[model samples]
Target: MPTSLCGTWDMISNVNFEGYMRALGISACLRKIALKLKLRKVIEQQGDQYLVKTLSTFKNYTISFKIDQEFGEFTKGLDNRHIKSTVTWQGSKLTCEQTGEKKSRGWAHWVEDDKLHLELYCEGEVCKQVFKRNE
Candidate 1:
């Protein structure tokens, strides 16, 4: 049987996000706020469809997409830019690619040891985050 990733996950730790924002050319002031943000991710997955929301006091981002389908995405509140986003599954892991002005911008999602792992990347920096499944 395949692993099921359907649940709410609360952010527990963020690693190397400062450099990730810096690589994305985020302003210093905004980077400071973004770095300190207590981000919460609520993910609803049914088969190959997904609705993921990233919430925070400073900004919120939501994405709705299907596996293996490429769609246009506008990053509202954060960056406020548009990009072509595509998500796919490599085994049980979910990988995404966002093609836009920024180089090598994308994210990946997977489960490890009952924890949700997210890796957000842009430019040359990668931000790793771990979240625990909310009961």
Candidate 2:
């Protein structure tokens, strides 16, 4: 069985997020707002399918995908780009690879100890976000 990543996680620390946003060509105005906002990531998983939502006061982003399946991903409200994306399990980590204008774009999610960890990468910049499970 796959390791469970099916719980609500509250963001505790975000490192290098600005660098990641800059690499994605996010406008300065939007980045300012995003940097200050608190975020909650809610994940629901059933077998191979998953629904993940990133909620914030400024904007919310959601995506649904199944393991090993390629899907068209439209990142609306967040980078406003369309990309072909796929998610697969690499050991205990869930990894997503996005193909589009950006090179080497992807994110990996895993659980460490009692914390949920995310590494969001675009181009060469990587943003690390640590979250604690929400009760």
Candidate 3:
């Protein structure tokens, strides 16, 4: 296996995020605010559970669960919706499937070339984000 995906990562690039936000039904004003904020991902693992936090100056969101176990998730600061989320390892990629009001919603995280890569998708829209490990 590659290095553990447990560390602090600061985003260096974000692409097509606006389209993804629009797919999530986020308001234009909120999308604009979200677009301006730099995002950070803090990943941790304890025993059989994993915690992934999306952090920003304005807001933070966290989700914790064990692989293959389905759980309920509330996107409190983002889209403000309840969803069923399940995370599983597909090869080196840790992927999540979110079943909610939106169609084709999910995200994947993996390490490539020593950098962290994230892909967020909703309703046929995809947002790709890349982050470097925080030193």
Candidate 4:
């Protein structure tokens, strides 16, 4: 059976998000706000379909897609850019590719020991985040 990612997660730690935002060409004001904002992730998984919502005080982003299916995505609050996104499972890790103007843009998600781990990358900067499962 495929791994299920249906739960709420609270941010525990974030590393290098400011640098990553800079690499993405986000404004300095936005980067400062984003660095301090708390993030919550709510994910719903049904079969091969997934809905992931990322909530923060500064911005909220939601994405819905099926496994291995490519879809057009617009990053509304984050960057206001369009990209073609595809998500696939690599073992227990969920890998996503965002193809657009940016180079090396993608994210990887995995759950280990009740903690949800995320690696968000763009350009040459990488942001690592850890979230604890909410009870």
Candidate 5:
């Protein structure tokens, strides 16, 4: 088993996020606002269960799930969409697949060199976000 990625992470970089949001049908105004806001991720993991929280000055998104279990998920403050989501471990990476209106929508999270990395993808557009662990 891989080491737990359970901790607070402060965003260091978010690249191609606007295009990824656009691919998800987000409005121009929301995308513009999202670009300026700072984001943080808090992850709590116990065995196969996980609680992931995304927080920012403008909005917050939270989800809880178990590895390899599929559940209904609402994007809520992020995309405002309903999808069946499942997360599984691919080697050391935590990968998620979302089934909804969009095509090829998903994200993967991994830790490298004490940094948390995330890649969010939708409709061929990918957004890469890197976060530094908060000590």
Candidate 6:
């Protein structure tokens, strides 16, 4: 099994998030606000269920699901889109596949060197972000 990805993480770097937002058709105004906010992630697991929260001063998004099971999700504060999502382990990465209006939209996460790595993708644009454990 891969290292557990459970804890609070503070983002240290983010790249190409604007391009990914553009693919999601986010308003330029919202994108600008999102860009300036420092993001954090809180991951937790219990039994077969998992919860992941993307937090920031501007907005926050949360999702909960189990591996290999499909669930309904509303993007809520982010894009306000409804979609079906499934999460599964792919090698060392925990990947979520979001099926909705956008093509190839999803996110992947893994931990290495005590830092958490995330890749958020929509259409063809990918945003890479790295976070260190909050503690």
Q: Whole-model Cα lDDT per candidate?
A: 0.88, 0.93, 0.95, 0.91, 0.94, 0.95
In Å, residue 84's CA in model 2 sits off its true spot by 0.5
Model 5 per-residue lDDT tens digits across residues 42-108: 9997777799999999999999999999999999877899999999999999999999999999999
Q: Tens digits of per-residue lDDT for model 6 on 1-135?
A: 978999999999999999999999999999999999899999999988999999998788889999999999999888999999999999999999999999999999999999999999999999999999998
RMSD, candidate 2, Å: 0.8
The TM-scores, one per candidate, come to 0.93, 0.97, 0.98, 0.96, 0.97, 0.98
Put down candidate 4 lDDT per residue, 3-77, tens digits, no spaces.
566799999999999988988889998888888988999999876789999998777899999999999999987
lDDT of 3 by residue, 65-96 (tens): 99999999999999999999999999999999
Residue 35 lDDT (model 2): 96
Scored by lDDT, model 6 comes in at 0.95
Which residues of candidate 5, in runs, are more than 4 Å off? none
lDDT of 2 at 107: 97
**What is candidate 4's TM-score against the reference?**
0.96
Instruction: List candidate 3 stretches off by more than 4 Å.
Output: none
Model 1, residue 96: distance off in Å is: 0.3
How far does residue 125 in candidate 4 sit from its true spot (Å)?
A: 0.7
Worst lDDT 10-window in candidate 1: 1-10
What lDDT does candidate 5 reach at residue 96?
Answer: 98
**Residue 63's lDDT in candidate 6:** 90
Q: On residues 7-126, what C-alpha lDDT tens digit does candidate 2 reach at each position?
A: 999999999999999999999999999999879999998877899999998899999999999999999997999999999999989999999999999999999888889999999999
lDDT of 1 by residue, 1-135 (tens): 347667888899999999988887778999888888888889897766799999888778899999889999988777778899999888878889999999999998999899999999998799999999889
Q: How much does each candidate deviate from the true structure in C-alpha RMSD?
A: 1.4, 0.8, 0.8, 1.0, 0.8, 0.6
Error of 4 at 86 (Å): 0.7
